[model samples]
Target: MNKVVLVTGANSGIGLALCERLLSDDAEGLQLCLACRNMQRAHAARSALLASHPSAQVALLQMDTSSISSVIAASQEVKLRYNRVDYLYLNAGIMPNPHFDMKAFFKGLFSSNIITMFATGEGILTQKDCLTHDGLQSVFATNLFGHFLLIRELEPVLCYAGRTSQLVWTSSSNAHRSAFNVEDIQHQRGTQPYSSSKYACDLLSLALNTHYNKQGLSSSVICPGFVMTSLTYSILPSFPAFLWTLLMPLFWLIRIFTNTFTLTPYNGTEALFWLFKQKPESLDPQAKYHSLTSGLGNNYTEPRKMDVDLATSEALYEKLLQLENDVRKKLKEKQKESQHVMHHGSFA
Candidate 1:
């Protein structure tokens, strides 16, 4: 039987690149499923993959990771279509209303932390996050919570006796410890909701390994470094396409000292594709794999110890469970109410 690989946000960027690489590497041994919010984009992605490998198996799934209902529905569809998921790539993420602090960027350029700033995007970028229909922070909902819900729903297929399943998250170098608070996992009070949510992912991945490793489920997070995707381009919305092209030389120059500039989507997926060939048991529970590119433009993966600890991760996990319960209860009530209205009448 062929291994099943499901990737969320697979329509573009690193997700699409990973799909291409996987199909190219083993067109006969793998089944590729591309889950995206937009069916048009998903079809296009599937078409593109099929165009290259006409004999490969490629499926399309519609999933909006920001919505709880959508994630649940998608997971149910997944379980109905496949016996088990060998690899689940939680790559869907959003960074909305990004603001790049040029003052801070310029200041960091002269400071000793220049390389750190360029590598991590810390102290220089922030985002304005809003609420989802589920009443959760949008960034947190899209980046972490919805993926968590999907995992919960897919537990049956993911956790099986004498078998292993992998959960690979597209985390980021921007996931700093300072941005996360156990009391504010959603970061409703903070401007850097993207960072906070990503930090939550790092913490959550650790907690998942602790809980599910014995059940044959392994979770690992990876930082794509500073990939120049649409998400990164949003950080500098004022810069035109031509201006960004003009800055490529400067970016490549910066790559000499800090190898975090895996600027292309293919390079950004180095760690993800690497993980595809690795044994889940061999991966470290406390480490985050990073996609790095040298000045020579060679792509590689490196594992670095994350700052997350067990206690905080556990606390956040419990809170997330509570939130999930609350949301499901509310959704149930709404469904029942709608049924009642149809049984009777809207009014009189």
Candidate 2:
């Protein structure tokens, strides 16, 4: 009866690294549920992990954080498979339309690329997704709202384990001071929607902590300092990413000066991996954990100013409650009508 931990985006990047760290810990004996969008990648990741820790119990469920229906289905699967959920790492995120200013990039190079990227998550200038089926900006939906919906759907299982259960959100240091306009939460007016979405997650995570901690759900936010992941790889053309890989070692030198520069997925997940070893009450509700990589590739933690207004967070929580209720009601009505029609057809 090992504690169940569900990590979204567990197929690659920091999510995958964190999964390995958790399973390798002989003391915890965590039963990992790798919630990933691509089943093939999930299976491959599981196979790779199994080669090392044969005794590890890892399950895969297809979860696209961008889709509300997918989140619901994945949560239902989790409910069916597990009796209790001890940890929910909401790590699936997207940086859509990361247009980088080449002139600014070159100018900042002499100073600190780590600090420059920390303020603006431009990893070597890449194009972003322009379309999403949800009719909203893809980044906002996938990075923030989708994870929010998954947490809402899994509230039953998450809260079943009591007050100790944790919700760790993978927020970012690039969550800029002015990235999010509370009125335009979708960031339709902005180019840096990814930063805005991460900012929204910070706000939402704080909201969850303030309102739900008493209800047995504790929420925290962590940043995986710029990591070389598939997400980043997709941002740029093949040539530039390849070129950047050559200069990655130099980035580590810059990382020491600026604490938020983690180059690898393993280093990026330090904050998240450390949280698994901590008690909920021991964490600071307002402080966001920053994962850092030293010049020598050693991992370290730092605290960042999580610009969270509790009053606004509470309002967002109330709004989410109304939205959740509306969605549940519509779903229930459809289900009841379907059942009635089926019953009549069977008898007639």
lDDT of each: 0.92, 0.80
For model 2, state the Cα shift of residue 33 in Å. 0.1
Clash total of candidate 1? 0
Best by lDDT: 1
Question: lDDT (0-100) at residue 240 of candidate 1?
Answer: 86
Give a tens-digit lDDT track for model 2, residues 251-332. 6666677666787788888999888888998888888998977766688887776988887677766766665676567767
TM-score per candidate? 0.97, 0.88
Task: Report the CA-based lDDT of candidate 1 relative to the real structure.
Answer: 0.92
lDDT of 1 by residue, 198-286 (tens): 99999999999989999999999999988888887888989789988987887888899888999899999999999999999899989
**Alpha-carbon runs more than 4 Å astray in model 1:** 110-112, 346-348
Q: What is the overall TM-score of model 1 with all chains considered together?
A: 0.97
For model 2, what is the error of residue 256's alpha carbon versus the real structure, in angstroms, after optimal superposition? 3.5
Q: Which ten residues in a row have the lowest lDDT in candidate 2?
A: 118-127
Query: Alpha carbon lDDT of residue 121, candidate 2?
Result: 55
